[model samples]
Target: MSEKKYSEKHEWVELNGDIATVGITKHATEQLGDIVFTEVPEKGKSFEAGGEAAVVESVKAASDVYSPIAGEVTESNDAIVGDPSLVNQDPEGNGWFFKIKVSDVNQISNLMNKSDYDKFVTESA
Candidate 1:
């Protein structure tokens, strides 16, 4: 597993070679409250860095999940669509929204590391 990269919008990406697994941060899930619904992107759909890639709704509100890096979605996790609580239970694990075939691996460098993201969340809160 590679080091996870984070976006200011609270999405995280862990790349393994050219494929990147994307998901919301645990902090994001906490802020969203109990997750109720999720809509993952379709396979083969391409997105630019920061593009809206998925939709997640909690009891509190609905939010768009963005791709931290430009890529073509290669897989979507249906488990979260069936049981949205999975995101709340494990936001950074099995709850991952999708995997993408990265269009530019270099884009990963533009995102924050875990420590930086933790600090960002702290200061922003």
Candidate 2:
């Protein structure tokens, strides 16, 4: 299994070769509260880094989910959309949003590692 990487915007990515799995972090889900709806990009759709690729709506608010690295969308987690609460229940695992065929692997260098993300979450508290 690949380790998780994080974006300052609160997204996370798990890279496994050229494919990357994406999701919102625990902090993000907690901030969003009870999730109600999720909009996932169609499989095979392409997007650039930092582009808006999905939308996640919670009881607290609706937020755009951005692409951490440019890539072609390979798969999406339909289970999470059908039951959005899974995002809050398991933000880092089964609650993953989508998978992407990485267009630029180097873009991941800009994201945070686990320790960095932990520090970020701590400092923001």
Top lDDT prediction, candidate number: 1
| Candidate 2 colliding pairs | none
Tens digit per residue, CA lDDT, model 2, 1-125: 46889998899999999999999999999889999999999999999888999999998788999999899999999999889999999999999999999988888988999899989999988
Candidate 1, 16-114: lDDT as tens digits: 999999999999998999999999999999999999999999988889999989989999999999999999999999999999999888999999999
All candidates' lDDT scores?
0.96, 0.93
Q: Where in model 2 is the C-alpha error above 4 Å?
A: none
Which candidate wins on TM-score? 1
Clashing pairs in 1: none
Alpha-carbon runs more than 4 Å astray in model 1: none
After TM-score superposition, what is the CA distance of residue 39 in candidate 1 from its true location, in Å?
0.4
lDDT of 1 at 6: 95
TM, every model:
0.98, 0.95
